[model samples]
Target: MSVQDSAETAVLVSEWRDLLARHAATACALDRELSERFGLCMSDFEVLERLAEAAEALRVQELAEKVHLSQSALSRLIGRLEKAGLVQRAMCEADRRGIYVTLSAAGDERYQAARPLHREVLARSLAGHRPAGG
Candidate 1:
């Protein structure tokens, strides 16, 4: 590769790393605060957040697209949520293999309660940081 190409690659990597670090920090803050305030982890909050946004139940596949976790991992997380009465899952009528996920009333309440803290954490964590291309 040309010298300029290598230099550009290094800069890109550095920028990406910075972005990842910011995400990690914000996530940690969210996890800590959410857990302390509401007995939830970051993953739990994220799933609840997504479900709250959906007008109706979401197919498991569609939810998988929205979250970062793999299918198996998301299934496990959903199982936990279901056990906690935070979410409900049902088999799709048209597709036996497909499952739909929806937030429970309790889950919606919890998400609403935590929403402010979540946004506050994000604002504080990314307070002075700028996007790579910004």
Candidate 2:
């Protein structure tokens, strides 16, 4: 390849882009399958998975951190899930300003149903994928 062409290719395949590309690929696969089968998006599934692992209801801030979403975004997502009856939200008794989130039975069921597909998609999407020049 010409030097200019090589440099352009390298830039396109930089480590950060490679990482993001791989994530996008895997996320797309997971989203498609999860959405079709369970009516859940990837973020929705992530919220439920995190809530399922919690011993008790998680504070909104805590869940937001775990799910890597801003507090406002998480709140909006929570609102959607709450509307769909997949999750329940309550004001913390100890601190009125605090909000707690818990997975409802339906959320758990959906998460359980989708877990295998999630794993399968992850494996299939990532299989044979590697960083450029690895």
Candidate 3:
């Protein structure tokens, strides 16, 4: 490759790494705070937020996609939420093989409580990275 091409590639790779690092740092901060204040991890909070936005129960596969987690990982997360009485699983009547997940009343309450904290942290983190007047 030409020297210009190599330079461009290097810049792109550096930008990608920087993006990933920022995401990891912010996620870690949010996870720590959520765990300490709400007894919920970042994944748990993400699932709850998705459920809260849905109009009805969400299929496990659909939820897995929304949360960017593998189906098995999401299933395990749901299992933990279920044990905590924060969510419940139900069989789809029309598709007997399918399962759906819904946030319980307790889960709604928990999400409501945590929503402000989540927003605050996200806002603060994003603001720190924003260019002035941009």
TM-score for each of the candidates: 0.90, 0.85, 0.93
Model 2 TM-score, 2 decimals: 0.85
Per-residue lDDT tens digits of candidate 3, residues 1-134?
99999999999999899889889988988898999999999999999999999999999999999999999999999999999999999999999989999999999999999999998888877776777886
Q: Best candidate per lDDT, number?
A: 3
Report backbone clashes per prediction.
Answer: 0, 0, 0
- Name the lDDT value of residue 134 in candidate 3: 62
Give the winner by TM-score: 1 or 3: 3
| Superposed model 1: Cα runs more than 4 Å off | 130-134
Q: Give candidate 3's root-mean-square deviation (CA, Å).
A: 1.8
Tens digit per residue, CA lDDT, model 1, 34-65: 99998899989999999999998998888888
The residue pairs found clashing in candidate 1 are none
**RMSD, one per candidate, in order:** 2.1, 4.1, 1.8
For each candidate, the alpha-carbon lDDT, in order, equals: 0.92, 0.92, 0.94
Error of 3 at 12 (Å): 0.5
Candidate 3 off by > 4 Å: 130-134
Q: Write the per-residue lDDT of candidate 2 for residues 67-113, one digit (tens) a residue.
A: 99999999999999999999999999999999999999988988899
Top model by TM-score, which number?
3
